[model samples]
Target: MEHPILFISIILEKLGLPVPHGFVGNGLLEQLCAPYMTYTWLVMVFLFVVSKMTLGNLEMVPGGGQNFWEILIGGLDDFFVENMGREMADALFPMLTTFALYIAVGNLIGLIPGFMSPTSNLNTTLALTIIVWVTHHVIGFRAHGFNYYKHFIGPMWWLIPLMLPIELISNVARLLSLSIRLFGNIMAKETLLGILFMLAGAFFAPLPIMMLGVLVSLVQAMVFVLLAVVYCAQAQEHAH
Candidate 1:
């Protein structure tokens, strides 16, 4: 039997609906999965559409889409400011917001039947974690210059040997933890949803499971964003 989401996409295509699609090929699949391309395409299209819609016309009275974007962006800005302070938040807002949105969208894309969340893939999560790791250090360096390394050093001169390696290991662990946390949660959600759907078939039994998957995706995205903010905040932290 055909998958429900694939079947729906097929029906929509037959009806001439313009659902975003990728050119399926093993060459593309060898390096990058179809969902990764789909997610990337969606993000590009989202940016283009938003730019065209809001551009210079953003005014006292905003359109629905602009208003929604404002609410999302504004809320995130406020949250980051509260955690990281105004100056740091201002510097990182664009990157943070972009990552959050991309991840949220990537997670949700899996619910569309044929598409799986690119975040479920370890490669995608590792790449995201590395970006966050680098950005956090950049913020740290700008905030404290060479003294940023001082943060990794122990409180005392003698402890530098002990503390530096420990700190280095801990930092390396963040890369693993961030990537694993994201990849594991997303993969688990998809696995559970697939199993539930297979067992329950078209019945309402799997409906709740589907909703659970959506909740998992959202919570995981928020967790990932919150952790990123915390990491950035730590990197910029001064005064011990």
Candidate 2:
């Protein structure tokens, strides 16, 4: 079935940039004109505007926006410290927080009418997984220098022949795991909600599913972040 063309795609089409109506298409044109790309850009711009508005006026006495942000930041900081130790968390706080917020928002946005979740796209999820994969490896390298490579090598030299390929495959599996998990969950949620809306019409019929979607969105985002932290923590550990 042809995927529904988003409002953003229509806008782009009106501007002489016609986007393909299907989820899969060919080449650079497909990548550039994908509806998910438009939604991803929308998510970015929404985040930027909201962040600017929230952080623009920083008062000594916190109001609603300031207080909410402070609580969120503080909570995330403590969570990271508990999971990955203080030093590592301090180094990773900003990036991890960005990932959490972006994923959470991207997932939830699809619950709104006339919008879609970028996280539902394999490209978006795979890009995020790659970032996390690179980040943890970089952290490992920085923490242990050349010794980071030792983690992939078996403890006993003889076992290297067997363990090396296994370790390489295991690491590669993380990329697939992270990307597919998020993409599958979000896409499933979107599909379910769409089906429910279609079968039951726009009334209160989809309310229950919408509520569940909200919970699923938050849980998936938390799971993604938690796994990322664990991966980074494991990376920094001394090879036994």
What would the C-alpha RMSD of candidate 2 be, to one decimal place? 2.0
Tens digits of per-residue lDDT for model 2 on 202-234? 577878989999999999999999999999999
Model 1 clashing residue pairs (backbone): none
RMSD of each: 4.7, 2.0
Quantify all predictions' global Cα lDDT against the true fold: 0.79, 0.90
Question: Candidate 1's residue-wise lDDT over 1-240, tens digit each?
Answer: 224354434554676645445423256342333445545666557667866877547777888877887888889999999999998888888888888888888888777666667788787899999999998899889889988889888799898999999999999999999999999988887777777777785786667767887888888889889999999999878836
Candidate 2 runs further than 4 Å off: 1-5, 24-30, 154-158
Q: Using TM-score, give the best candidate's number.
A: 2
Off by over 4 Å in 1: 1-29, 50-56
